[model samples]
Target: MTTSSSPLTHFDGQGQAHMVDVAAKAATHRIAVAQGRIVMMPVTLALILAGNAKKGDVLGVARIAAIMAAKKTSDLIPLCHPLALTRVAIEFVASPEDSAGVASLIDGETGHVSCTATVETVGPTGVEMEALTAVNIALLTIYDMCKAVDRGMTITEVKLLEKHGGKSGSFVNP
Candidate 1:
């Protein structure tokens, strides 16, 4: 929350989660990167690669969905503060996509299509939730588009990869 001692920012002394008061805090350049992936059959991956999925452009649509979702993070989650994000970049990767890790092509049966959202804003609060929401929405979009062909698609590795700015300064996940 406030980078104070309290472990949770969304709650009060009574522990009921509330929107933390960010009005008093100084606005800073804050950024958060969130990432996740959808694991599917090799055929599903081929369809995405070939742009032959019945759902139209899979990664293209998912990218837009993620950015839109990040911007609407506050509305989607009750406790989140609606933030004016400066940038929301959704990068899609096909695996064995090692680098940024949006998608992967590890084994024969599983193919990963990962989405990473980088959210930036000059605000008092962090964009971690927004980033996370973006990643989730992106992965969900992928699942929805391909469900007819691959109902077994699993969303995994959804997390805030890192955050910068604000009182916390910086955090890199290990």
Candidate 2:
């Protein structure tokens, strides 16, 4: 469980779960970036690299899934507000070079592909949930598409790398 200095935003002062009213808040440009990795056997990696997965293009399908998931974040997560996204991007790389939206990719013996989701919106609410949802869905889709080839695949390090806009302003994971 996590605790906050202030009341949890999803709950009212009375401790009841509720959708936050952003009617009084000013609309601002909001953006969020998230990343996660799916680890699998080297053989499975080779299959994906060779486009031999039985379920068609794994990364291609996952990229679309991530974008769609970001747009439908409100429907999937209770208390989240739906926003008209300005931009959404999903990228995957075995070894990433640090850039504005992507985090420093993990370098390890485990064969993993890093999936990064970047979401932007002009609204009263932030798009952190949308970015995170996109990453989660992307990772899950990768697992689903590759399950037959490697049931041992694991989704790990799902995280909200950064967020910008709203009253809280910008935040980046250190």
Candidate 3:
């Protein structure tokens, strides 16, 4: 597990929740990337890949939802600073087989769809939350779009892949 030497910044000595002040910090270019995956029935994945989902264009709509979610992160999370985002990129990939390299079997057949979101901004604080938010919204969009057919779809491994800029410096998941 990863450990931090510094104390949590979102709380004061009294343990009251509060937003961290970044006004005194200098503006710098910041970027963060987050990713997640959804596992669903192979047939459901086929429907999505074949563009036959009842909702229409699942990935395309999810991409747009991710960008919008990144921009609106501050509104969704109270402690987050509202910074002017410079860029947001969302990508989705569909895999016919699971990571275990198992081939599609009758009832056990499964498909994986992954979403990655990269968010960039020039500001005092980092955009980690924005990137994470984007990934979550994207996955949720996928779930919403295909839930009628695959109610058992599971979203997993939602996490920050890396981050750059800010006083704390850079971090990459190992």
My TM-score estimates for the predictions, one after another, are 0.89, 0.88, 0.90
lDDT for position 45 in model 1: 84
Off by over 4 Å in 1: 1-6, 97-107
Residue range 1-174, candidate 3, lDDT tens digits: 334344888877667778998899989999999999999998888788778999999999999999999999999999999989999999988886446533343677688899999999998999999999999999999999999999999999999999999888999998
Residue pairs with clashing backbones, model 3: none
Considering every candidate listed, which one attains the maximal lDDT? 3
* Candidate 2: regions farther than 4 A off: 1-6, 95-109
- Model 1: per-residue Cα lDDT over 1-174, one tens digit each: 343445887778766678889898999999999888888898788788778889899989998999899989889999999888899999987875446533345456588878888999998999999999999999999899999998988999899899999987999988
| Alpha-carbon RMSD of each model | 4.5, 5.4, 5.1
- For model 2, residues 74-95, the per-residue Cα lDDT tens digits are 9999889989999999999863
| Backbone collision tally, model 3 | 0
